[model samples]
Target: MASEPPDAAAASRRDGGRPGGLRRMLRRLTASEAEIEAEELQRDVERHGCQPARQVERGQLVSVTGRLRTVVYTPRTTVPTLEADLYDGSDVVTLVWLGRRQIAGIEPGRALTARGRVAIRDDRKVIYNPYYELEAAP
Candidate 1:
């Protein structure tokens, strides 16, 4: 039998050989459903060129894309706020729109991209009055 060069062997290993298949299967078997979903969402975030919620820093202006997990309208006597939790599979960032009751299509399971400065309120990541664009339903 002929022997392959060291470089060729390395290339095959990097290009998804038997080892890669085994690793991928093991990962799928060991990872939870939520973890796998999160990974997929993270990949989508990268494809959209937006920052992941987990990596967003306080006081930094950033754009994050994710699915809305929840939408709640808090109607206070003074100020009304519409809040939605955007989950990027890595973390959640709360989006708050002030002085409003609700906006059409701002609902759970809807995907969107929001841009604003990150803030920490009650130990949770928040973006107040963010500029957001709704993603088409998938």
Candidate 2:
């Protein structure tokens, strides 16, 4: 079999042998802090063998690991709810605990792994009363 020419080999090495290598590099260079953080979180999710939030189907039991983007307590006439948005880079899954104000260790920027059945409300993914484990602050 014929081998690659000298120029071809050099170019392949320079670009890591992939056409989109340069594009990916450029994207990484220009990515915002949040984007970079999301990418890192995604990698961590994969490393820990947890399901991604974006791929979770409604009604399916899943365990997703991510950082909490926001935590809010909403008070209603009948009950109160604590909600947090868990972002795993690909998507956000809201965790809602009904009749709760807040829980210790559940706050913004904290890492967590939550397991529950997925549900959709008002066109967003939510898990109600999920069993969650808070990760140590990094």
Q: Estimated TM-score per prediction?
A: 0.80, 0.79
User: What is the lDDT for 105 in model 2?
Assistant: 94
Report the C-alpha lDDT of model 1 over 78-131, residue by residue, as the tens digit: 999999999999999999999989999999999999999999999999999999
Off by over 4 Å in 1: 1-19
Scored against the true structure, residue 132 in model 2 reaches a CA lDDT of 94
- lDDT per model, in order? 0.92, 0.92
- Please, what are the lDDT tens digits per residue for candidate 2 over residues 54-124? 89989999999999999999998898999999999999999999999989999999999999999999999
